[model samples]
Target chain A: MEKIKEVVINNSEDVILARQAAREMARETGFGLADQTRITTAVSELSRNIYLYAGTGRVIIRALSKNLKKGMEIVAEDRGPGIPDVEMALQNGYSTNRSLGQGLPGTKRLMDEFEIKSEVGVGTTVTIRKWL
Target chain B: MDKVPILKMGDTLILAIQVELHDKMAIRLQEDILKEIHDTGARGLVIDVSALEVVDSFMGRVLSDTASMAGIMGVETALVGIRPEIAITLQEMGLELKGVHFALNLEKGMELLQNIGEIFYGED
Candidate 1:
C-alpha cells in the first residue's frame, strides 16, 4: 500500500489547474486516460460549481495506491452560500446557473464514487474518488 | 439570448443562434432546427457559442450528432465564434465535434457559408 499525498489549491481558475495536476499525478501513478478524463470532468464540474455558485473554494487532491492499484480522491470545499436544496440540485435539468444545468448531475455520472454534503448558509463539500 | 435571421447571396438563409448549448435545451433546439431546415430547406446554420462559457461532453456529442443529422436532412451546420480558452479546454478534453464548421468570428463564418450552396442543390 502506497502512502496518501495531498495537494490544496485556492482560486476559481485553479479548478482547471487542480484537474491538470490530478491528471498528471493519476497518469504517473498508473491510471489510464479514460480514468483521467472522467476524473478531470468530475473535477471541472465541481470546481466550476465552487467558482460559479459559491464564488470561492479550495480543491484538495489526494493520491493513493493500494493493493497494486492506483486510486485518486478529490475534495472540493467552499465557504460561500450553500445549496438550499441539495436534492433538487442533484436532479438532472436543475441548475441555479443560467448557462447549463448539467454541472452537478453530470459530475455525479462521471465519477467512480461521489459524495456531497452541504447546508444552507454554511458551505458545500464534494468528495469524489476514482480507481485505476 | 438573442435570435436573429441571416440572409446571404439573396437566396440563402442562416439562422443565428446565441445561447448556452446544454443537455436540457439542446435536444429540443436540435429537433426544432432540424425541422426548420427541412421546412425552409435553408443552406446553413450558424451557432454562435461565444456567449457560452462551458460545454459538457454530452452536449458536445449532441451537437456533433445534430450536425450529422442536418447533413442527412440537406442542411449544413457551422459553429462560429468559440472563445480560444473554451476551444483549448474542449480540445484537451478530447471533444472533437464532427460534421460541423468553426470560425473565429461570425463574419468569417458567413464568408464560409458563401461557398456552400443551397441545401436543395446538394440534395440530388
Candidate 2:
C-alpha cells in the first residue's frame, strides 16, 4: 500500500475535505462515477462519524495493489473514547447520538472490504477498501 | 462558506446548490430557506442539486429535514437533479428521503411543485 494523503477530521468541514480527497483519488484511479460516488460517500460517513463521536480523527487514503488488482484504502483513526460494543456500533440505527446511525454499516456496504478495531477508552480505527 | 443562492419566482422559491456544501453550510442553507419562506410567504420550493457530485448520508438527512421543515411551514418541496450515481448510492445507503418530492431536473421539479399546488388548491 502507498499513502496518498491524510485529512484530519477535527471540525465538520474536515468531513467534507476527507470525502473530497477520497473522490479525487478514486477518480485518478480510473474508477467510474458510480464507484467514485460510492468511495466518497463511504469516506463522508466515516469522517463524519469521527467528527461526531471522536471530536477529532484522521483519515488516511492509500493506494493498494496485489497481483493485477488495484484498490483504494481509507483508514479512519481516532483517539477518543473507544466503543465498548463494536458490534452494536456496526449495527444500523444504533447511534448514541441523535444521528441516523447509518455510518458504520452503510460504509461497510459501500466498500468491498471493511475492518474495524477499537477498545473501550482506548480509541477506534476503521479501515475500508474498494477495488478497481 | 458560500450560501446556496435562492431565487424567488412568483409564489415559489428555487435553491441551486452549486458548491460542494459542508455540514455547517448545509444547515445554514436550511435555516436560510426557512427564513426566506417565512419572509416571502413562498408556497413552493425546488432544490436543484445537479452540480453536486455526491449527496452523502449527512447531506441526505439535511435535505430530508429541510423538506419536512418546509412542509410544516406550508411550503411544498421538490428535490431535483440528483445524478444517476448519487441516486443509486443514496438508495444503497438506506436513505429513502421520503416525504419530499423528486424529479429528474429543475424544470420537472417545478412542474411537480405546480402539480402539488393544484392538489392543495383547485386548479383554475
Q: DockQ of all candidates, in order?
A: 0.08, 0.73
- Cα lDDT computed for each candidate against the true fold: 0.68, 0.89
| Residue B69 accuracy (lDDT) in model 2 | 97
- The worst-scoring run of ten residues by lDDT in candidate 2 chain A lies at A97-106
| Best-fitting candidate, scored by lDDT | 2
TM-score of each: 0.56, 0.96
- Candidate 1: give its CA RMSD in angstroms: 9.8
Q: How does residue B56 of candidate 1 score in lDDT?
A: 56
Clashing pairs for model 1 are none
How much is A94 displaced in model 1, in angstroms?
0.4
Best of the candidates, TM-score: 2
Model 1 stretches with alpha carbons more than 4 Å out: A1-12, B1-124
Per-residue lDDT tens digits for candidate 2, residues A1-132, read 365899999998888889889989998888999999999999988888888888998999988887999889999999989898989988888788746777778888889999999987878999999999
What are the runs in model 2 whose C-alpha is more than 4 Å off?
A: A1-3
